[model samples]
Target: MHHWKPPPPLSLSLRSCRFVLSFTPAPAMSASSSSEVAPTGPADAIYRDRILSSKLYFDVPPSKVPVIYSSSYDIAFFGIEKLHPFDSSKWGRICQFLIKEGFLDKKQTVEPLEASNDDLLVVHSESYLSSLKSSLNVAIIIEVPPVSLLPNCLVQNKVLYPFRKQVGGSILAAKLAKERGWAINIGGGFHHCSAEKGGGFCAYADISLCIQFAFVLLNISRVMIIDLDAHQGNGHEIDFSNDRRVYILDMYNAGIYPFDFEAKRYIDQKVELASGTKTKEYLDKLDEALEVARNNFNPELVVYNAGTDILDGDPLGRLKISPDGVTTRDEKVFRFARERNIPLLMLTSGGYMKSSARVIADSIINLSKKNLIALDSPLGRK
Candidate 1:
């Protein structure tokens, strides 16, 4: 398919922007082909440009230190409810830091998502799709307040279609990573959403959909998911359990989101992290988890859920990990996967701070840097 033109810049006071993206195989098209070219349109959006945009993009450190990550994406505003809220809330401090460094700017480019039925089917059901079309999407998923259940009226008619925008962002991030190598979505990692009913705090199975889409469209089989989110990667487990090729390292509270009352019959590899778990403990568990990924479910591409909510201050996070510790968690996950050339597709999951007035959006960007620099760079030196 031909790549489309990008959209315009954001209305917010921003300095710079980078296009978010995914990785997929370059169709028979040559490297120099215009189709093979990076994003262009309103502001030359690409995950690299946006992520690397640094302070101009957010209030974080200048991207000057040269971290890691770079991939194409169409997430501009694709993440359902995750985007606008993430930008304003406790993420302000991080945004200030980026601004101090010039990673972000008012002129940054942005765009919404576009998820197709074919992609949604990678993990969802047709009957469920019909239910979504009937606007039962959000309602079936969460009972939070009087939420609209469906997104906007236009696509809201098709329940999954609106949520597809968020799904499409993941698809774009993964495609950018697979094709160009290394992709990420500032928003996404809806792991609790299942094939039928969305669970816990999730409404869509993004990682599951992306993995299945990779299986069908990309024709790549045997995928692995390294879920380090504060919560269990339950959605992925239930979706890819029988496949065997897809393994899960779900490190979460034993009874948080999915509410594992007795047993979790769907999960492949589950790890219950005790509450108040600190950086050292989480890293130890992460190392063990990586060993599992490397030894057992060693697949071609590894879909990593780099959730930062595991940090100590995260409202939804039960663990007591710190900011540097959050970086460490990401460092361990990305290094382990990238060292072996395992294509990684990352999405930000649950992260709510006890102090909503001061969140750390930089943790997300920091992971993107590790995504880019951890390998060839001296940033994460021994």
Candidate 2:
């Protein structure tokens, strides 16, 4: 209902513009119906620096459309916020499978949680929150598809809790990174949310608000949001476009979702990698990303969106990167963050291909880990 004025105009190379997919909007749902569902995964994890790390709380549903705007399948799969209901078990199944593959620590498991209204206010409107409450009170017929990620704020206390939990994971991730050192939020990658509105595939006020809030609470000066989700961080790009304190490193395909509302910012970088880009070529492109992040944006605190869709064989992705390629990508990016001694915060932005998703998650986890990032739960910690 609100018209957003984009920041300044930023342009990518015309030659970089490659294939753009045509997708129709999924059927819309009444506000009340939207609140009743949850995404599938561990309830409150992905807040750590690892894939199976105690940070990711995956309640997201996977049935929604996979990530767009990339030629890389791993990039597209990493774009998936929630797993399909049918694929819900597949998430843990993938987790366990990774355990079998020696990729994940065998001790990890995910659970569920319902967040509070106060927790949600960090990113969403109070009106939307109240509406979600009233819907859950009346128990209206839930009509939306099980695969959808964005839910309406007009349902039961239980249904609406996932938003809070997901955001809580993001907020807590930022808080942990600020307090201890570094953290990764696996679920909350809502990079496209403007202050009041949600666009592109990003819904739910996740990382955007967390940092916006940290500017005050955490006193974060010169925070960097490095969005590698394969789509321009249109919402985030638009939000911090004019501000010099926050820099955006968005490496996404040109001319894609959220319709590119013509936004620009200081020290932002976007590189286009086309479909069927071989592993070595993508690695070369990553070197460009490294130069841009290090040389252009000398960040004190770096928020890394470790999207998993850059892999090959991703149903929703167009790029042809293999699992090893994705791992290498994570290594290069993580190494860059680690070597600089920059405090890092990360998230599993998007994902689809389950097996490859597990690999990317596990690989990054293997690299950027501290021995102390353990489960908050006493039993798990013990």
Candidate 3:
């Protein structure tokens, strides 16, 4: 286990102090059962039962487009959201652009239900969920130090609620994709959170949960995760590490956060980019990576984590990709899935800049223009 040093006494807030005082070691798991998908056993039966009984996989009306979102997906408090570099209202802004430009009607967008504790239990441990009760743990996961001072109730209502709603959207996107050729969740892609851990602004393992639900309810055996976020998707990588059913194609700036060496070992295809990688170089690597992924395994569902952080001049991502480059990147992934007749779901993940919303909305518009996706109503009007 990696050793961690405690902070100085003065820096430890009330929440952090409580968390530190109550901290305990996690129970070790056998190597065989470490993976989220272990061999058939009693635990497997429980997972299946929980998934089968979940309300998150409900059917959507044909009138509504498969663009999952909710107002609750955007978090806004007394400006506490500004503490982190992330634009907490990015999801709402993406929809606003689409609406203002008449590309999509707000009523046509599907609003997802909040993922309940039972739903979260399918991927997250009970202890992990309990740990979130301490605002300090959540603050650390989201990388906002001031959040440690807020009451847990306020944190849950103002912060975690939005994330849970997005988690719901991610899980539901898979089902929508299965039904409608392709779907997009306006918010989701918490790829840095695993079942037992949350970090890098990812408090829930939505990607992992989405695939797990698809495996059980959608009757699909194989999944491919095309994570284009500038950061490594270590959460899902670790969850599906030992499971042969999931294939991961991760392209990220290696000089970023969550430099998890152990998680890197689980990636089936890893394309590491430097800090200043440009649009052409990034796309070229993606083309090669997609070709390699195509030859490696056939997936029933493709989960695309289309993060706009790669756009040039982003402080966190540090990559030099252009806005148009992001559009082309999305087109490539959608075309890849369309060509193979595989259902695809795209999750807007990891991009934090204020311009991310405009760029994402533009990409969706481009996808519509390219005939790769249908944004209009009646279920099939491109």
Candidate 4:
């Protein structure tokens, strides 16, 4: 197996590095037009304080696009991440394809700060963060048994640090979405983790953290979660179960992992697909589901967990969605938010295959070509 390494510095001239993205913020977005009264009480006050003090919510200049990613998002120490089915290096690979194909400029991509411990406290319990200090606990959470043998410091640096960076990206995506109408964080969607637990290869509750930060920082009350990963998004479901402000629409293979019946109760709309479901049936169900969701909730922001694991031959997804099907699936979701004038934040959730990166890049390219998202070089002229 090949060891993952950071891409070498490009040979671009200094003049080329100064290209700026001239994107116009979407007009008449209901999310930015109004604000929800912030929640009160001591616990909420603490959460709000942490969010207010976070450095993850920094301002981005027009020179950078809303696509957030970093080479540090890849986990590759000792190659132990290969023990699991996940592509640990998929985030960097996705950006590499977009850059090499000229669909995106590397200089235009935004790099996010890592989510600090206090920033994580916005959603996770202090005890839960402490639990991750044990290498064995983290190993179990990620499902990589070999990681347990490593020292906790190495595990922290190699595994959890990347996840924290992704968590930061997820949190920052909401702010960027509110400004740009849409934002894509190429390495997030840790949907199986809750405030107190992390499992199913999810080490952090990035989705929950993102939404919580949105509630406090973005001043949005009504939020909708469109989770299309092959597995149930139990993390955010549990986190937002008692809160009426967040609406969840989850479509997953009920026959798969993390069958949390308790968390399933919280989903406002759940579409469970059986194993071996094909592309046509999947897309048809998505159409009906999106329609039902539109009628059910008028959310200010939409968080889309677009997992490419549904592609044909993904062992974990257990579905038969084609490459084109994936592309169309993304377009439908982008249109769902763009047409409604709602800010949208998309997280590249759970596609574990090596081809998942290429598939995701193609889908983003298609979104740009269809005028769903504004990028630096949608026409690939640069």
Error of 2 at 295 (Å): 1.5
lDDT (Cα, tens digit) per residue for candidate 3, span 1-382: 0001222221111111111111111212332232334336677777778888999888888888889889998888899889788888999999999999888999998898889998898888899999999999998888788899998999999999999999999999999999888899999999989889998889999999998888778867788999999988978887877666778899988777767666777788888888899999999999999999999988889999998889898878889999999999999999999999999999999786899999999999999988888887546424
lDDT per model, in order?
A: 0.51, 0.48, 0.83, 0.83
TM-score of each model, paired residue for residue = 0.66, 0.64, 0.90, 0.89
RMSD of 1: 13.9
Ranking by lDDT: 3, 4, 1, 2
| Best model number under lDDT | 3
Pull out the clashing pairs in model 3. Answer: none
TM-score (C-alpha) between model 3 and the true structure: 0.90
> After best superposition, candidate 4 residue 107: deviation in angstroms?
0.7
What is the Cα-based lDDT of residue 195 in candidate 2?
47
- Clashing residue pairs in candidate 4 (N, C-alpha, C atoms within 3 angstroms): none
| Alpha carbon deviation, residue 81, candidate 1 (Å) | 8.2
lDDT (Cα, tens digit) per residue for candidate 2, span 1-382 = 0112224434543312323221101111221231212213442221111212322233322221111111111111232324231122223443444456653443333222333554445445567545444432212212123323333332232233444455556655665555445555445566666545454334455666566445434545566787766555666655554455666776654433433534433226667656566678878888887886687766667777766656676543456777777777776765677677666666766555657446755664455353223323221111
Task: Name the runs in model 4 displaced over 4 angstroms.
Answer: 1-35, 377-382
Tens-digit lDDT string for candidate 4 (1-382)? 0111212322212212322221111111333235654545676677778888999999998878899998999999887778788898999999999999888888898899999999988777789999999999998888788888999999999999999999999999999999888999999999988888888888888988888788778878788999999887878877776666778999988777767656777778889898899999999999999999999888989999999888899878888999999999999999999889999999999987899999999999999888788786322111
